[model samples]
Target: MKLAYFYRNLNQGGIQKMIVNAANYFVEQGNDVSVVLMIPGGEYVSLLDPRIKLIYFRSLKKSRLFFSFSDILKREKFDVLFTATPSLNTFTVIGRLMARVKTKIVISERNNTVVFFKNSALTLSKLTFLSIPLLYRFADAIVAVSKGLGQSLQKVALIPANKIHVIYNPAWSPELEKQAGLPVQHEWLNDDTVPVLITVGRLVDAKNHALLIDAIALLSKKREVRLIIIGEGPLREKLQSQINSLNLQDCISLEGFKLNPVSWMSKANLFVLSSDYEGFGNVLVEALAAGLTIVSTDCDYGPAEILEDRYGFLVPIGQVNALSEQINYALDHPIDRDLLISRAREFSVNQIMQHYQSLFSTLIS
Candidate 1:
């Protein structure tokens, strides 16, 4: 099988990581795999399995990139073209048509489309929202990371229910446990006296890191707790200011992005997610793999499904008080380590890859 993944860049985001994992998995399974990028490079570009080919359209301009992408499809005509995110998915659909390729197009929706359009301020977002109904019908299959997101896509885009398949992300890789075992020499993680709470995501508006900071402040008021936010983004300075303003500089630290956040998760006492929304909370599964107790916002599409109330606790989104209170409660009563580890196995990379292979095979057959 010749499989190719299309994305803007191979950044460290959850979607990008899933693509890298899938590409690696398929290539190892003896399939020829290629990663097609519109933008030339990203941090995750180095993480690709050496066996997988890296193809770049290499243009900052959308029109040039689109034409370049179509040309590749016309020339290569891969067995399957798997694309993530709305922008790239749209391009793959229209580009395949223009190129007159017989490639089976599989588009993965990694966010709640309704929430995405509602929160987005960009004009391009509006255009993409409009294009979904017009473009996505051409794709061979549509994969939503969560059932909530699958339903949301149906409502928002008017996509046929039968066209959508709910496939969870490949979150638990063998490397996750291996990385978790690696030495992490952070003061907060090293100190057993103070409880350390960790969260991982880009410091973007949807992540609502500010709300997490406020919750940490509230959690600190009652007892000693420390928070390590482990991703970098645009809101870093603003979040730092918020930390300084609330005198939480000592308790909260924005440790930027670490390639192996599992190392930190393995040592942390608790894992917290304060996202306004998510396609699926990958970090939560990583935490579960690390045997850490979790407190996540019951945001659209992912957390509730992942945690399922039985695995971990979920609070309403953006409710600082509720988030803080739940964090405190979760700390008091942690879930069983063995149970959490057991649950994490369901999302192992090998298992998720089988579902993807099944979809691709069905399309080709």
Candidate 2:
């Protein structure tokens, strides 16, 4: 199979990682795999497997215009086209109309469509969402990262229930294991007296970083807990101000985007995700893989589904007090470290690749 994977960029995100993993797996399995990045380029370009060819469609912006992608589709003959994100849904739909390649197009939704469009700029984002019944008409299949997200596509986007399939994001187990033996770079994290709490994601409103900060402030009053948030975004200044106001300068630290977060995850005593909503908490899986006792907000789609009673504790979303309590409880009665590692195996790269193999066979057969 000659598979063409389409994505906005090769950024350090779950969806991008999934696409890279799937494409690389397919290529290693003797299939012709190529990645077509909509955005020109970025740091994650190096992360793509050297074996898989890469192309950049510089003209493919996050807009309603379809000429650029349609032109590419007309020239490249692919057996299957796996397009990620809703922004490219319209492009794939239009490609089917204008392109010579009769590619079997499979569209995947990485985020909640309703939440994504709530503040989108493109007039067509709203229209494309409203016209999902028609936009998806050209798609061979629609893949959702979680069952909850699949149901949302059906309920909110009006996509047919029969057309949406749930496939959770593959875990970062391989990377975690690889980095486990690596030396810890941060001097502050070399100590064992203080419990380190790590959160990995963009510092955004939806991520609810403020809540995590509040919870950390609450935790600081009693215990020796150090919070390290990885990733940079618009919320940095606001979050820094909150940290200063709460006098959490010593307890909480914002270490903006590290190329490798696995080292931090491996060193951390605990991992927590406080997102208000998530399609699939990829970082939570990474944390679990790194064998950290976990605590997460019971977000709409992922945390409750991933972190069951055995693996970690889930508190109600936006409840900083409850989040703080759970963190304290986990710290006091730490879960069996080996058991957490054992549970993380369920999301290993080989296991997830096999799932993708099965889905690809089923979709293209």
Return the top candidate by TM-score: 1
What C-alpha lDDT values do all the predictions have? 0.90, 0.81
lDDT of 2 at 119: 62
Model 1 is weakest, by summed lDDT over 10 consecutive residues, at 57-66
Clashes of 1: 0
TM-score of 1: 0.98
Model 1 Cα lDDT, one tens digit per residue, 215-249: 88888989999999999899999999999999998
Which pairs of residues have clashing backbones in candidate 2?
A: none
Candidate 2 Cα errors over 4 Å, as ranges: 58-65, 119-124
**For model 1, what is the error of residue 217's alpha carbon versus the real structure, in angstroms, after optimal superposition?**
1.2
